[model samples]
Target: MAQAPDHAPDHSGEALVIQKVQPFGEGQIVLTTPSLDADGRLEDRHSAYHENRSPPLVWTPVEHVAAYAIVVEDPDAPREHPFVHWLIWNIPGEATSLPEGLPNEASLGLIGGATQGVNGAGKIGWFGPRPPPGHGLHRYHFQIFALAERLTFGPNVPLETLVSALKGDTLAEGLLVATYEAPESQ
Candidate 1:
């Protein structure tokens, strides 16, 4: 049996501190909005059916991090492996939040020196959750990594490249989860 590529070995052993995700208010890593409801149904406006806006994200900063990376994936996708929805890197260490609805572009000018990579759909930046219709509820995992060194890679690198580079260099990490289910009708 093949080991999961997304499951990095937990070597850091509780040394890394992951703070609560801010969008859900307090004491929560799993978040929800009317657009991304608690019932695991995403609003059409936040899906491919409509506007497809990226949800806002915020977290407490870690100490001594030189840069940060975010990876969003759906482990429940009916495939050989999890599906990547977003890959963002080179976020300035001082940064702590991503505003809602970032443009589908490579460079996010408003966010300090941040850049986006290709998503599972092969599009740049965020590709909001749009699981196959009636595929049931899929959990979207939003993982943030604090790196000891700033990444020197250019834009649009594959997620594997980023993950490979992160080995042994992760200073801290955080996680947030949201769920979405495609409407049965379509």
Candidate 2:
């Protein structure tokens, strides 16, 4: 029988890299879904539901990170991701990812022991895009942060509470944005 190739193929078309650095602050770093441009401006779609709901996050890697945290949000919706669609933390230091459909409770191994913060609706999990009809595509941002240590946001801390806990302690941050239009609108 023929022996298999010793080295695996390189399927990674374009590897992820640290493009630049930004101060780890509320206004310094930001995340946005596919609906917006690099400038953080809104895009067309005429419905927040088309917002894809998953925001693209971008941030600098911490110099000495013991752990990391991620928070996906949608600020324009008068709500938290409008108000915390997803909250995940305690990621390891070697990790540099927050792929799509992640922190998803339905999907196994996405967030084994990570904390899930409460959303605007008072739920303790992810809440996908449900933007109102004709309400232009709202921006959703998936914010990732490099922390100095592993955190315990408690059993069900809201986004604000978690943010408060992270005060004066962020080391690095990033974001990944994705856009989605509702079926009828699409």
Candidate 3:
């Protein structure tokens, strides 16, 4: 079997280090899904072949943060920039964990006034890995930003706008990486 490489890059300067607390502990964020293996390869179940649900995530927030945001992207996608898979913001600073199977809706009532934004595919909510066949492995980065203030944007905001709004306002951030490749025959 081909082993998945450690595709997670070093975010030394500006990126904040996330402290994972569940599923796995105190390292890269653990994406708990029977659909993926220890090395972050996505199984058929978590891909387009089956139910494409968001993976459960848990982490510790930095002190004094007023709000949090999450952005999941595929940096290896064949595009000019990384392909966004999920974008959510306005997570209450008090929240330390996100439950599995988050609903594919605009407003997440259960997550402390959190809202979903459009992904790279121009859709809302979590879009699971669906890399083209024979494209080798793709790294999916799940990044969380700790902001010093609550954002004013509404749901379905564009990725660029959200990113721009975060500038100079981020207190800290964390990252978790996962990898996936499409079946050769698919």
RMSD of each: 7.6, 17.7, 8.7
lDDT of 2 at 140: 52
TM-scores, in order shown? Answer: 0.77, 0.59, 0.77
* Sort order, TM-score high to low: 3, 1, 2
For model 3, residues 1-186, the per-residue Cα lDDT tens digits are: 998545633221222112221111122323333445878776655565457778777776567777778888776776556777888888898988887678878888899888888877787788888887777788777888777788888766666677767765576666777788887777
Better of 2 and 3 by TM-score: 3
- Could you give candidate 2's per-residue lDDT for residues 23-91 as a string of tens digits? 354433344344456665544332234433333333444556766676655554532124345666776
Return the clash pairs for model 3, or none. Answer: none
Choose 1 or 3, whichever is better by TM-score: 3
TM-score of 3: 0.77
**Residue 185 of candidate 1: its Cα lDDT?**
74
Q: Candidate 3 — worst ten consecutive residues by lDDT sum?
A: 16-25
